[model samples]
Target: MKLINLITPSANLAELSSIASEHDLLLLRQDAVYLVHKAALPFPGKVLALESDVTWRNITLPASIRAISDAEWVTLSANASQNLLWS
Candidate 1:
């Protein structure tokens, strides 16, 4: 499965949604963690947010999005078939 990392709040949702599938994983980090506040996620896949980022921003994540640690982020990247970054 692909691991798609979003590092900015302005990352193109349309472009991301076009390439994402249910088997993929979408990781929200840095400013991208703000996406969890949106009404709905653009990706049709499992969504994970960096716990520290969310906490730093003082934003509470929705039930649909999981909050993961830095170690878990590394593990997810290591296990994925491909890693893609979207700024």
Candidate 2:
């Protein structure tokens, strides 16, 4: 299954990038204004959007960011973050 991670500003992007498996899709902001799918891990998994460049805002992230996430928005801790972003 594919997972879409709408990361919060407080979360760590670097860690997720390093270990994330090549099966997840990351959709985030790019111009620090809107969202973009930056990179991908591998086949069946892709990392989309530039995490560092994007601006982190609750409003912009949730609703206007990526067409409103239909899946459950899981609040992941630093540890669990890896699973959500990478796993």
Candidate 3:
């Protein structure tokens, strides 16, 4: 199943890794966007960050993290077979 994981806080990397699977998308927003600067997410799945949030916070998301527009975010969420929000 296509899973989308929305991370809104700074989650533990190990915890994330433990649950992560291939191609499970992870979207970072709010405080969680900070993770991109510190390090790429542990998950091997696709990683995206909210563009505006990163811009407003002045966090330069790394190359490993793709920046997604609002429309893209909606599309991603909508396409997911399951949506999991982790705060």
Better of 1 and 3 by TM-score: 1
Best by TM-score: 1
Q: Write the per-residue lDDT of candidate 3 for residues 1-87, one digit (tens) a residue.
A: 355545556566668667778768888877788777564456778888889888999987667788998999888778888787776
> Candidate 2: where is the Cα deviation over 4 Å?
1-4, 27-45, 48-87
Tell me the tens digit of each residue's lDDT in model 2 across 1-87. Answer: 244454453344566555545655555433322333323223334434443444343333333233322232243222243434332
Pairs in clash, predicted candidate 1: none
Question: What C-alpha lDDT values do all the predictions have?
Answer: 0.93, 0.40, 0.75
| Winner of 2 and 3 under lDDT | 3
RMSD of 2: 8.5
Candidate 1 structure quality by residue, lDDT tens digits, 1-87: 999999998988989989989999999999999988899987899999999999999999899999999999999999999999999
Task: State each candidate's clash count.
Answer: 0, 11, 0
TM for every model, in the order presented, reads 0.96, 0.32, 0.83
Worst 10 residues of 2 by lDDT: 70-79
Deviation from native of the Cα of residue 44 in model 1, angstroms: 0.7
Backbone clashes counted, model 2: 11
